[model samples]
Target: MKQDVDSAKAVMRELFAPTPLQHNLFLSDKYGARIFLKREDLSPVRSYKIRGAFNFFRKALAADDPAERFVCASAGNHAQGFAFVCRHFKKPGVVFMPVTTPPQKIDKTKAFGGDFIDVRLHGDIFDECYAAAKAHSKETGALMVPPFDHPDIIEGQATVAAEILDQLPGDANPDLFIIPVGGGGLSAGMTGYLGGRIGNESFVFCEPEGAPSLKESLTAGKRIKLDQVDNFVDGAAVAEIGSRNFDALKSFAADQVMLIAENAVCVTISELLNVEGVVLEPAGALAIAALEEMDRQSIAGKTVIVIVSGGNFDFERLPDVKERAMRHSGLKKYFILRMAQRPGALRDFLNMLGPEDDIARFEYLKKSARNFGSVLIGIETKRPENFDALTGAFDDAGLRYEDITDNEVLASLII
Candidate 1:
């Protein structure tokens, strides 16, 4: 495996140099540990994905019967990487993305492939798009470039670990490696490469809380497809771990996988952007976000490596990202209140709020009766505990309100 990865690394150099492995002072100081970030986001296509795509394409082209065309399905990073590889090899390719894929990703994929690729908008979700891509590959005899399931893809991704081991300062091994898992390609490849060099206990895998396919599969002793998935963390929101990828990961215990909330990931994204001026997509933020969830005592004096997976963020989503971060930090909340329709009612409610409390949203549901109305209110505050005092004041004033901030269904419907 190491030899294969070394060969893959050699192939990778033909395109782009290895991504940097740098110590992160802010994170190191915050955790009281030596923290290093494998900046895969710095790759030519802004992700580690390019490595796999390049390897897959290189091997395919060298085969006795080279494919005339390539087809792939992806909503974001993978598609871009595939497109970039196709353009580099001057091969015709087709990329199928979900109909609901963000325009920024679609545009970037098209831009990467230039005239070498065709972008097709397929189903509303990835599984549907993947099926369509597969059908097209079968119909046209084009080679299918899967995101993370193939052996060549796995071998290509292992190059990341090779680079890490080669680039670690002073050649000192890290006590822990926090890796983010989506389809399990990168984690599987890294673990496979580190088989002889690093112990299994040294690895920690992270996945979005809304999608725990790897954890579930490990628990079931087999691959388990999730019935539903939250797409907020789009890069890592896989419904099922790839079969081959799962085979590489199934040996790990289920408890080894940590699930991070979507909102928590948003908080990390906002922090990295605001404090470090480092832009990361949600999946890219996973490893860093896992640091907050780890036991400080266990990691305080350890050397840790976190993989920063990708940086293909769309700036247009910044407002929504900030909103999720504030909500996760308990600095913002939504409420449903029954208020008198008469004049000065809102003023009275405002007066009850603490000095630091500010109304971020206020809307009457337009279901007003003769004397009362239903109101949707969102509040932001400097501290979370201020809400206790404000709510106490509301109670004392005989106001009727429901704290719907944590109510998923209610928030989805109205907030």
Candidate 2:
């Protein structure tokens, strides 16, 4: 398996150099551990997805009577990777993406493939788009290059683990590894390559709290398909772990996997961008975010490696990201306030705000009401404790209000 991975890496060298494995000072200091980041985000496609796509194509082409074309379905990183490899191999391919996929991703995927691939906008969700790609593959006899789940794709992803072993400085060994899970390609690949070589205790898996397919499957002792999935962490929002990938991970106990909140992931993404000047998509930040949930004593003085999966973030979503981060950090909140429909009502509410508190949003939700009107308000503060003071003032002033910050349904409908 190592030799096969080495061969894959050798072939990949023709496309891009191995991504850097750098020691992150800020994280190391904060976590009390020697923390290194496997910068897969620095790949040519800004993701490790390129590895699987390229290796899958390479093996298919080498086989006798290989399909003349290829097809894949992905809304983000994988689509870009598949497109990139198609262009590199000069092979005609088709990529199906969800119609709701951000334009930035769509444009980048098209740019990477150039004339080698055609981008098709399909259904609004990934499963629907994937179905369309499968239909196309069946009709045209084009090879289906799955994002994960195949042997070749898993082998290709395993190259990342191979690189890690070679890149560690001065024969130093890592005590822990943080890997993010989606369809489980990277986790499965890395474990398959390092399972016997390294102790299983060294591995720590992370998944979005909204999509715990891998954890749920491990608990059930089988692959379990989720009825619904949250797409906020688009890169890791998988409804089911791939069958082949699960085989590689099934031995692990369910407790080994940690569920990271989508909002908490946004906080990590924001911190990395603001403090470290490093941009990472939500999934890319998962491994790092999981560190916040770990007991510092467990990792103190130990060496840890976190795989940063991808950095294909669209700037257009920065505001949304910041909003989520602020909400998660308790620095921002939304509320529905009952305002007296009379003079000085607005001034009364304004006076209740603390000096550090600033109104970010305010609108009269129901002005037609006779005596009292519903006011939708959003507030931002410098610290989490500031909310206590502000709420106390509101109570003292007899201001009728309900905090909707943690109310997902209300926040979604109004804020």
Off by over 4 Å in 1: none
In candidate 2, the residue pairs with backbone N, CA or C atoms under 3 Å apart (3 or more residues apart, or in different chains) clash, namely: none
Task: Give per-residue lDDT, candidate 1, residue 200.
Answer: 88
The lDDT for every candidate, in the order shown, is 0.93, 0.94
lDDT of each residue in 295-392, candidate 2, tens digit only: 99999999999999999998888999999999999999998999998999889888888899999999999879999999999999999999999999
Residue-level lDDT tens digits of model 1 in 25-120: 999999999999999999988999998899999999999999889999998999999999999999999999999998989999999999999999
With candidate 2 superimposed using the best TM-score fit, by how many Å does residue 96's alpha carbon deviate from the native? Answer: 1.5
| TM values, all candidates | 0.98, 0.97
Misplaced by over 4 Å in model 2 are none
Count clashes in each candidate, considering only residues at least 3 apart in sequence or on different chains.
0, 0
